[model samples]
Target: MTAVVSLVEHAPARAFPLPDTVGRALAASKILEEAAPDSYERGMWRLRAGSKVGVVAVAVPGGETVTVRITPKVPVARLFFLLGYSSDPAGWRDGMVDVAEHSELLPALAHAVERQTDRALRRGLLQGYRTVEEASLVVRGRIREAEQIRRRFGMPLPAEVAYDEFTTDIAENRILRAAVDRLLILPGVPQTVRTRLMRQRARLADITPLVRGQVIPAWRPTRLNTRYHQALHLAQVVLDGASAENLPGGLRMDGFLFDMNRVYEDFVCAALREALRPYGGRSALQAKDVHLDECDSVRLRPDFVWYADSGTPRIVADAKYKAGKRRGYPNEDLYQMLAYCTAFGLPEGHLVYAKGSAPHTSHRVRRAGTVLHQHALDLDRQPEALLAEIRELTRRMVAGVKGRI
Candidate 1:
């Protein structure tokens, strides 16, 4: 039987009587860390978890299996909401992807993926035209004259032909297949879910399995693929967030983890962008072309930036998931936003943070005369209430821009 060590996100370090191999593996992986020497305990290893939450199973020497499970600070359902909203703000609803049945993240995600994939394949696999080029006995479509002359020496037989072949082995089915396979490997998936995932894999047997490191094939949303849109989105989340790796000395590690910092940032940017749509301006997440200096030496990428129809920057904001100090949000974040304000020539900039003891506050830089606003969002709130907060925040941002004009 595999030993299990459970920890909560950002919780205090705990000591565990673990084998040296397992301890060293977890320490080297950096998914969990050893406690500082001052807090260290004798005869046991002290391990602490940060913001990453998920289950990782490490297979060490002596045929021992150790599983480390990190629970998130927020409810699993709320985390799913953040994930779904970040991926598809317009289409994602609270219960659209059912995860209420499972308490753990891995099981919940696996169940959701299985259900969505089943729905997507209910009408059978989608078929699309794939352009294929090969040497064939009979030329079906366009023939490569240059290749025919160069390789075949003008031989009439085995012509190099290119044609579009309609098949089930397309990008959509392939992604779904990859997600199913990934879940089937990870630990903690219920046997029932695993069985269903196996069936999904069988259904997608004809489709090509994705290579481990290669980019996932892209698929577009259209009327024909409307049924696949939800499944495809979830499939990508699985492919991008989960990892399986093999280490030296017969050690293997695999898990699905979510970084709260990334999740919070993505949710804030996506929600704000969706809320700002009604204001009739363009919004960008992580705008890359921005800079703080005229020489373009100091490039700055703000989490969110809104632009006017006239191609001028209207508002800029950054998202911070870190805890605020007793005074307020960190001063470093204020300095970063100030730079953004100066670069965009805006009178005000916004800093959105996860709700802490500190209330919403605004600071005016004395010399620059730029107003920097700090906004807090409570993640524990219901989906509707959380979105309403974003809508209200959008209003404040737009009002600030108008005041400047």
Candidate 2:
């Protein structure tokens, strides 16, 4: 049966009937829970990401199943860049090409996979085998083994010799093969792409199957091997959670999921850093050990903290992934931001939320000498426009700080 797959970002719940097998997979992944208890034919599921991003598949043996690729709601190109950024703080964009027109996550993933594979192939599969030293009667690596065995053993007719040699179990080949093997099982990968991957995999015929949790060797940097860096990282990301389940009917596999909170927070903090760079201030993310109480026990970790050159806190900003329209901002969020401003002795704090009905709003704390600015960023906007909004916010924040100074 054809798979029923849906690509969705972190959003509202989606309902669909799921077979017991597929339901179990989703449940294990914590992506969904049964909406209605009674009927096996009726089930509900939604995207639940806990600090991860990418494609993850859900399937059932010999039955219809759904493969949901949880990704960012932003434009496909931006999302790709963001994913690339999340993996590495720098240098992830080197091999990535322009792919904004591709909307869905699967196609984008396939495109990346194909491109990376081709790049790795062009660089030549980093092929250096490990030494496999063993004692044998038959001649192998060198006659030194036979001489050693002859000296050790009294029976000289059939000499037991120690031989030193290497096997075909290579690091680069294994990683590439693992990636290709994973792509082949991923449900929505096109036939052409799969064929390409297969060809790549076949070239690494001597490579042993990469065992789960096996440590992939980190190759040293060199001019010739630099091209393999991005592909190796991609291969690792694709093969990290690659799994296949053998059941009574058939085999099923799983894919990837990402946390929207992390994505939003990272994007905002990174953009804010770039936006604030020219202003000559310090920006720290996940600032640590902020005491909320005099006891030094209660602490708060604000997402981003901008400090003036004088070492005074200017803007304490937090990124909220939820929409304000849906149930509005939590009272705790306000209290937390307020405490951030108060603790830092700042006149105002900032809360950046994803797009909502109210794009920008502010709240003044009466008699508290503190104000809270809430700004919403539309992640769906063009990359330049999105960063521009962040820059505008930074300017206002800097101006607000300068006014007080």
Candidate 3:
């Protein structure tokens, strides 16, 4: 029999009396390592989930399994909205990929993937031209002269050839196949969902399976691939957010989890960029060339930066998924935004937080002539209201820049 434990995101630590092997498996799993710290304390295992929320299962020795489920602070539907919008801001809409029927994240994701993939492949597998390179017995398309001469000793028999083959074994199908495989291995998938996923897997049986530890093949969105866009995007979300691994001592760990911190940041940046599009300037997420020092020794990457039409930075912003403390949001966020302002040579910088008790506030840095603005976004609001808040925030950002000029 398997033991189950439940925890809430960012809640107080709770102690569970777990078996030694089970505790060790959880500790060794990458999910816990990335989300929590020092899980084992005293006799009972003291576990607390940080920003990550989802379900993970560990198979220990002696046929025992342990599953840990972390519930997010936000509603599952809201969480899906954040994920969908962040994944595809232009194409994603509310109820586009419905998770209303399911309560938990994994089942919702599993069902969504199955439904979307089915719709994508309804007309049959999509075939695209994939470039191939191989040494063939007969020269087919274009022969590699250098390789043919050097490797074959100037022989004409087995030629090194390259050609484009139209096939269903492409990036899109492979990604969908990988997602189905991942869901099949996870423990919590409902039986009906699992059966449908198995059908999806059988449909994609002709597609190539993604190799472990290799970069996922990339696919671009185009008119021909329009039907596959939503399914491929959701497949990538699954591939990026889920993990399965074999642990030491004959244990296996598999999970599907999302870091709420990252989800919040991505949603804010994507929404802001969408909102700022009409302002006639380009917005960048995590621009790498930014630095705080003249000598380029101290590097800084703000979550969002908007450039004016003249190619000068007009606004810089960072996203914080943190709640405000008694005094306020940590002073570190303010200092960080201050640095972003200084580096970007902007009069103001912005920090957007998942709303806490403290309302929107601004502080003028002492002696720096730079202002740090903190905006709180209520994640619980309806999607329209939430995005409306972002548009309002965008207006304020643009207005501030124009006022300074």
Candidate 4:
């Protein structure tokens, strides 16, 4: 039977095994020395080390392979550059400069900046649809305040102050703006089902609690949900008040900002799958989310399952949010891939982690009379160089599965 080798990059890098990806990245770095003298000039390895990053690159056989280049695939450099933390000058760009001070404000500012500047404009077409109504309420409040209250408070309030007022508006708008343009702001739907606000509103049939009762009570909202909801709500307001073409773009950016985060997993999975495809395999098998059936032993669902021309499980890849291997591969992962490997009784199973600061590759655990190979996959290299290493790793994985290497 032919061999089908596959690599899966860690999408949510932290969820998977970080060390494994780092190991793979480092493993590839070791082979960089062998890259054709000048075939691929620039080669390097950037591993995670706590708060900061550790980047080390080797000059190809020739001089100065690459001065410096920024890549979307490499999250570490982008994160550093976005935060005005790049070690070199060339890595800095207009957007990074444009967002320099503000970049440090957002928690995942680097990823957000990338999405705003580099990612597709329509990348998240349906995201706004998820909270369309809530978005409408939030934005509506802001538009109203910018038109109404901000000026009513004398001068335009500081953006920070406006932000707080906007929160107050969305959470308690139904009560606050009673005579909004003679529209009679009748008490209506609470905008979401999670809230028991409606039950509270049901009791207050008299004057209706706007500023004092509802809005004031919401002052110290507990979880981040209210904030997220307000953000979503504000988004819709902007959508409605804004022009048509930019509406879609704005929605996509907001959604991408909320959902798509650049982590080591995204990097690792990209490399892994890229390696496997050319050799008769599929990299990402968005196979339906596996639901663990705890009937007898354990059954699993794998995000991606690959096979060579010979119909054998070549690689079982999953992305974890945390570093290191957990107790039992999250039960579902174990059983799903076990069924994948055992169904065909393949030789090995591989679990890839998002590369982290730890520094070692992965471990081999023996279970059910089979060898499960867990490894760290890294994501610190030139795009082309990284792809080449993926190809080689694919070859090695396939050969190992076939007992040929």
Clash number for each model: 0, 8, 0, 38
- The parts of candidate 4 lying over 4 Å away from their true place are 1-267, 289-299, 310-312, 325-340, 357-368, 379-389
Candidate 3 residues lying further than 4 Å off, grouped into runs, are: 28-30, 33-43
Which is the winner by TM-score between candidate 2 and candidate 3? 3
Q: Write the per-residue lDDT of candidate 3 for residues 1-405, one digit (tens) a residue.
A: 988988888888778877777776676654553333344564477777778889888887778688999888998889988988998899987788867488888888889989999999999999999999899997788998888888999888888999999999888889989989988988788999999999999999988887777788998999999999999888888889887788778888778889988999999999999999898889999888988999999999899999989999998999999757866788899989888888888889999999987898999877887889988999999999999999999999999999988
Q: In candidate 2, how many Å is residue 107 off?
A: 2.6
lDDT of 1 at 100: 51
lDDT per residue (tens digit) for residues 70-99 in model 1: 988888889988988998787887788888
- Report every candidate's CA lDDT: 0.88, 0.67, 0.87, 0.34
Q: Which residue pairs in candidate 2 collide?
A: 52-258, 52-259, 53-258, 55-256, 56-255, 56-256, 57-255, 145-162
How good is model 1 by TM-score?
0.94
Reference-based TM-score, model 2: 0.72
Question: Higher lDDT: candidate 1 or 4?
Answer: 1
- TM-score pick, better of 1 and 4: 1
Candidate 3: residue pairs that collide:
none
Query: Considering lDDT, where higher is better, how would the candidates rank from best to worst?
Result: 1, 3, 2, 4
**What TM-score, computed on C-alpha atoms, does each candidate reach?**
0.94, 0.72, 0.94, 0.35
User: How much is 148 displaced in model 1, in angstroms?
Assistant: 4.0
